[model samples]
Target: MNPPFDRLLADVLACRHCEALLPEAPRPVLQCHPDARLLIAGQAPGRKAHAAGKPFADASGDRLRDWLGLDEETFYNPRRVATLPMGFCYPGSGRAGDLPPRPECAPRWRAALLDALPAVRMTLVIGQYALRWHLPGSGSVSEAVGNWRAYWPRPAPLPHPSPRNQLWLRRHPWFETDLLPALRAEVARLMEDPAA
Candidate 1:
């Protein structure tokens, strides 16, 4: 049988696998349940999300929620949706933005975590880092996101919802015009699935 959710969550909350390397104390921010139908596979938390101990607690999250056509209550409900970041802890800032998720995380924890979520019907693979690991050699974020049709029933790729990417969004009008509608439709379909 799979591990109980509370027990697994406690262990993950107490993890210190990257303690010595982290900029701050380890605070893994993710939510999951065996019955969830939707999974938001993202990169690590930003400073705001780290502070809140929740993934996607910033503008990026707001935009992401809008894209998925999900309200706060539904999106945050563990039974309805699960969130798993490539890196659980926040990887400090760099010259550009927050640094990439620590390489140690996904290899150490992803498979086990995924196994626990037996009912996940759709996973939204957000950002380049997540896309790299989940959809390797899948080309750039834009390319992967643009080819949303190919990753069906597995995980659909998406650009990070950060406001910093406004330029990219403006340039790639099809993302908003073409992709968001499909993403919302898929999410609605998954939420309505009785098997989920």
Candidate 2:
């Protein structure tokens, strides 16, 4: 790993600033490299991801990879893509679903970590928290995702690619027909040679 990135990652890995507040012990999870061209930002690690010590280690990840037109090897290749979330640890479940990512995470670590990724040409902001942080507005996930072009060529808001959102996917025919084609083409181009 590059020294600066290695240091930043080490710092993140060692972080336990909110361990006391977390339901379980802190276990930050993510994959990244300074050379990455595609940045996939999501809400936070889920229970499966936390246990696996990697981000997106469940059906959600499988769906996410499919959405990006990527296979596991390519999607997990840190040199080509970076997977960072709004929070690094599992925030535990709530009556509705997984609770919102901890309030402290972004304020503490977001900027410094993002700065390490100078080569990221496009950022796919997944779910509400990621969208709020990356593309601030009162707009709902559906609205921001639909208005993706407004933030084109840099950060694009997307609905969470969870199986739970299967209904949403069914409802939004345009996401598949309109946005994904362009998104995939860009990903394919970026994968050819991120260093370019």
* TM-score for candidate 2, residues paired by index: 0.95
Residues 1-196, candidate 1: write the lDDT tens digits. 3457678777888989998988999999999888888999999999999999888999999999999999989889988989999999999999999999999999988988898888888888988889987889889998888788898757788888999989999999998888888889889888877663
* Model 2 spans with C-alpha error above 4 angstroms: none
Per-candidate TM equals 0.94, 0.95
**After superposition, candidate 1 runs with Cα above 4 Å error:** 1-3
Error of 2 at 81 (Å): 1.1
lDDT of 2 by residue, 1-196 (tens): 4898799899999999989888899999888999889999999999999999988999999988887899989888888889989989899998888888888998998898899999999999999899888888838999999898888768978889889999999999999999989888888888886454
Each model's lDDT: 0.89, 0.89
Find the candidate with the highest TM-score and give its number.
Answer: 2
Give the range of the ten consecutive residues with the poorest summed lDDT in model 2: 187-196
- The alpha-carbon deviation from the true structure for residue 167 of candidate 2, after best TM-score superposition, in angstroms, is 1.6
Clashes of each: 0, 0
